[model samples]
Target: MTGTATLLHHDGTEEIPRFLGAPGAALFGCLHRPAGVARSLVVLCSSIGAEWKYNYRREVLLARRLAERGVAAVRFHYLGSGNSDDGSPDFAALVAQARQVEAWGRAESGATRVGYFGARFGALVAAAASADTDMPLTAWGAPGTGAGYFRELLRIERVGRLAEGSAAFAEAEEPRVRLARGEPADVVGYPLPPELYDSAQSLVFTELAGTAPRDVCLVEIGGDGSARRAAESLTERGLRVHASRLVEDRSWWLHDADWRPDETRQTVRNMIEETVDWFLTVLPT
Candidate 1:
């Protein structure tokens, strides 16, 4: 499996479609529905800004592997990302949307158990969504804190300014810069709407939704120890959660410039194997 093109398979052990899921919504996704009997169904959650441009290929391979292993999987784009609808839906709405997809998966696939596989912001969304649904499920690479990622994104944006060689802008005494009568400002791309931005700005880790004995496998893709911290917090709350680093995921697929955007590799398979063992064996159903 490679890209969405590769996702358009209908043969046994291949991804299929159920366009009947959400009628008015315009999300782009593929369902690797079961050919024979399925043991479980999984919905994959992606990052904010998606990272879908770079990570979609990897997800395709992962979804296919899950399907091949008898776990029917659904990989879809959230609102405002990919072929999804306009940039209007907020984070909570996105969670509901995922649940909507999950409902469809259950109705159509007849899965005995349902689960989630998330990456980055998707992890946070998955956690929130699972908390809302009364489903016994598993989470992978779940993010407990949402606003923390936004702060890091702001830092990345600042560094991006420096990379463009704008010393005056970079060395400015403060972050906020007012309009100068003799100077000017350029908005290269302000495509993002304020609704999403404000929502992301105020997000925090909390037990707002319902609780389940979740089996969480934290995939740390960054050097930061936030994954560990999140695991500790969840455990303290009495949730069955554990954090583990896919040590080379960041080195190979995360960094910019060197990312081989459209290749299927063993890294994804390795990740699935580790998480499956944790979710299927160690974590309670």
Candidate 2:
């Protein structure tokens, strides 16, 4: 199913909301189509929890910008997130979902070439989904390991409880204990199941199997060296990688109550411009 097209700009770029996959198990997505025929399509994978909410607007702008540059882009939510169906998907299931979206984007956009763009946790998903395929990839602020990312989520939950003047330590430990008992844990509002948590804990990018993409761009936001290390590791595996560092505020961590207009604008612009430029460079003619 699809929603009415909303004109994004006078340049003939439009955003169409869509529901892909089987009925009742559909994944929610927005397809941004360019004015003319697009030879390429970039699928935007999103991080979960609060990070997904924070990056929503930026991703919308990124999709619009890609469409404006004659590249179709689709941003979608996996199962149990956003407007999609409700179900806890494990890490491998998440990767499968991304691959499904990539195929759907290509068929829906009629783009001969397809690529992936993901930030934070989504970066890991994108990389895993693109394995054994020739699809180009752009990953920003990807965590080195799933265990670390899961721990960070727990930390966020703890910090949030502390800010509320509650028993932060106990609340934080509760989730780990629940997961240990083979149950789902509510980590920062996301109900993470034990299977997903265990799979995520073993996810290490450098240890991913299969062939890597020929073209890759690893972006580091706020001078974090993680992206550089990821790029180096991927390079050692025979992937051609471009590492870029952006000096901008961490807008994804900022809440609406702490919104800073100028800083947010700059961050969005830098991210969009860098991504669009890189996409255009590697996009097949």
Candidate 3:
């Protein structure tokens, strides 16, 4: 066994499922190690709620593909999500978690470097993390700010509730929403505590004062060009940025039954290819 972790599985590659961070509140993580020497290790951050449910398959595929390319990868649950312990996942703790996981991946795999790849809300977390630490990063479908994300979550929740019935709101008590204050807000089946909201409201990427990672890539799923704008903004801040766009007809983050099997598979393939290719291109010769 590597370190004190248990070997969870061994199909084509070895998977280590373990807990990390301070005792009594450990975050669950699955580390995928290559059969040979790893080129690098990357932590894949996930979006929350329904997005998380739909994107799990894609993330798993990406991890396996990375392992096949001789790169170690980690897919972990944030403090309060998935298999992790119950606790409010705040921005500070998330940033710290990314940094710590990066360091741990480097140590565990003996890789020359460690990087990050985040999707949706996870992309924002990755960007904020880049401001705190220097590392190669890939942000896919990232928003401009945390407050915007908070609003999006609320919108999603409202739409979901409305689909049930018009009288739903009238009969049921709603979760009180507050910004910049520590309060419990349950949006779309996820319990978000006060610190998370307070920190999220202040996360404006363009307004951030810290420097981003030197190597960065921003990808947009469709033609909105938010990723392009973010790339340009980061370039203006003196950070090298690469941008790309992929065609997506609908929101893959949603749990809609409208997705065609072939189209969904192709979309996931495009994302994995673009992400892995960028990592390979940026590696030092």
By lDDT, who's the top model here?
2
Candidate 1 similarity to native, TM-score: 0.78
Judge candidate 3 against the unseen true structure and give its global Cα lDDT, from 0 to 1: 0.75
lDDT measured at residue 247 in model 2 versus the true structure, 0 to 100 = 77
Estimate, for each residue in 1-285, the C-alpha lDDT of model 3 and write its tens digit: 123455544545667777776665777778888888876888888887777777887888888778767788988888878877777868888877776676667777778877788888888677666565567888778878888887878877777788889898666455543433456766777677777777778787554422754778888878877887887888888777888888877776776567655335777788898788888776531
Cα lDDT, model 3, residue 36: 80
| Best prediction by TM-score | 2
Global local distance difference test of model 2: 0.80
State the weakest 10-residue window (summed lDDT) of model 3.
1-10
Ranking by TM-score: 2, 3, 1
Q: What is the lDDT of residue 199 in candidate 3?
A: 73
Estimated TM-score for each candidate: 0.78, 0.90, 0.88
lDDT of 2 by residue, 1-285 (tens): 645556566888777787887777888888898988989999898887778877777788888889989999998998988999887888899898888877777887889998888877888888788778778888877777889988988887877777866665554567888999999888767677887888898888655522654788887776668877877877888888888877754455446566765335776688789889999999963
Clashes of each: 0, 0, 2
Q: What is the C-alpha lDDT of each candidate?
A: 0.60, 0.80, 0.75
Per-residue CA lDDT of model 1 for 1-285, tens digit only, reads 113443344557656554333445656667786567876788887765624455667677777767766677887877766666654666777788788778777776778677777776776677677774444344444445565665555565566576778775556432223222222222222233345545655555435222555556667765567667767776776666666766564443345555554444466667767766654563222
